[model samples]
Target: MSWLVTGGAGYIGAHVVRALVDDGESVVVYDDLSTGSAERIPEGVPLVVGSVLDRSALDAAIRDNAVTGVVHIAAKKQVGESVEQPLHYYRENVTGLQTLLEAMASAGVGRLVFSSSAAVYGMPDVDLVTEDTPCLPMSPYGETKLVGEWLIAAAARAHGIRAASLRYFNVAGAAAPELSDSGVFNLIPMVFERLEAGEAPRVFGDDYATPDGTCVRDYIHVADIASAHLAAARRLADFPEGTALTPSTSDAGRAARSGRWSTASSRSPAGRTSAGHEPSVTRQVSLADRARELLGWSARHDLDDMIESAWQGWRRRHG
Candidate 1:
């Protein structure tokens, strides 16, 4: 059974592709090359260059590859950018996904694995978020992800497509330095950008419920996310109606930042004080055990491992 991986040349998507390949699955990569680099794709895997919004392209890709499943990862994922350009976000993320779904249905692709996000929960007051958590997205990017989930679930119910939606949080680290994320939208890369400019990593607000008054963000290894995709893909036959899973580490958000500054401080001249305070405990929003019980998945790397890998990748690409 061949799998068509949309956005497979991008950071996380490439890792997912590698993981599936490592596990001996036949894989095809579909990417637009907008943010995705063709070099990231593995040799011998077919690369389909097109937007997810292009129905004809998707059909051709699926048909050419004899694809039976899809791992949809293409999207515009910037929170601030989404706020400034909501329509673009909707058109690309929402409409692009709709087009893909329509193509999949037409092609008789019965299995789907959708790459979703933690942003769908917005700013939840809960200590932990489960699959059942109410989704009130604050940004257009998050809204698009939530809507994508709704679309996948609807397709699953009506079209008999087995699917999985993984709402992963603050993804850091890489399988290799070359596979590291180049964009600075994420916290680890954003901090690297600030350090490159000789500026301190800024903390927006500190008067929150956390011990150090910072918002929480659960960090996960990109490899673990890839493995979870494999797990969900393997178990898709079990979930006939499609399901949602949250792949997360135990330490999240503000807790991830404040608790692990020491790990980052070891290499930076700005040190632990760069964040403006010594490491302190903070409230964590755990992604509940749904993924564990169902997909048999859990995060493998720790915060130190995450920081170290990200730093190495940043230096390799930028320095």
Candidate 2:
């Protein structure tokens, strides 16, 4: 069956599209190109340049392309920006998802693979965040994701839709240099930009009670994200209608879903904070236990691989 991938031209989206195409899936890209690039679309994949908010366009794309499933990745995804522009985030993320779901229902499409986030957990105090963890999101972006999951669940129950939500954190690295992330929002790219500017990488928050007095974080490779999406997409068609699942991690071993993975000062390239305080290191193993069992998916990249690939991408773009 043909699949429509929203935001397929973005860094992560491009990688997801490539993974799908490489797997021999018939694909179509639906994007507004706001933060996405046209150059990222695969050579043979047809692109429908439009916003997810436009239901008419979405309907047309699904109908004309014979889409039976969708991988929804288009959203306003910045935590800080979501705080500053809550209305915009709610509209674009929440409302945009609603519009897409409506279009999907109208077009008789029942399979969906939604891109959720660990941000929905919002700094949980537990050592491991399972699917049963209470999703107490702190920021607008995280709230939108949690709400999006709820929306997907509601639709699944009422409309016989089959869906899955993939929750992840700290996406880094790329499958290729050209597919690398161009934003400086995440930890790695932020460090890359700071060092390139002849300045020390800045680490925020110094009040955590951890060993290094720094907050802990979990990281995943973008390629892993794409693979998880691929796995979810392929598995959805086989599940019974109204079935729903949420996979919390990708690849590695057991992920550091709980707080305080390690001493930050030694684990990352941003060795020391500007004030000479020790930065924290992440303790990510691979909390994707559910993903492995449900979709037979696991992350292949490690922390070092993530950093090195991202470094390669930075050099290619900045040099």
What TM-score would each prediction reach against the true structure? 0.90, 0.90
In model 1, what are the clashing residue pairs, if there are any?
216-253, 216-254, 217-252, 217-253, 218-252, 218-253
lDDT of 1 by residue, 171-206 (tens): 888989989998987878877776777666666556
Error of 1 at 148 (Å): 1.0
lDDT of 1 at 253: 37
Root-mean-square deviation (CA) per prediction: 3.4, 3.9
> Candidate 2 versus the native: TM-score?
0.90
Looking at model 1, residue 244 earns an lDDT score of 44
Give the residue spans of candidate 1 off by over 4 A: 241-255, 258-284
Cα deviation at 26, candidate 2, in Å, is 0.6
Give the Cα error of residue 276 in candidate 2, in Å: 13
How does model 1 score by TM-score? 0.90
Off by over 4 Å in 2: 205-212, 251-286
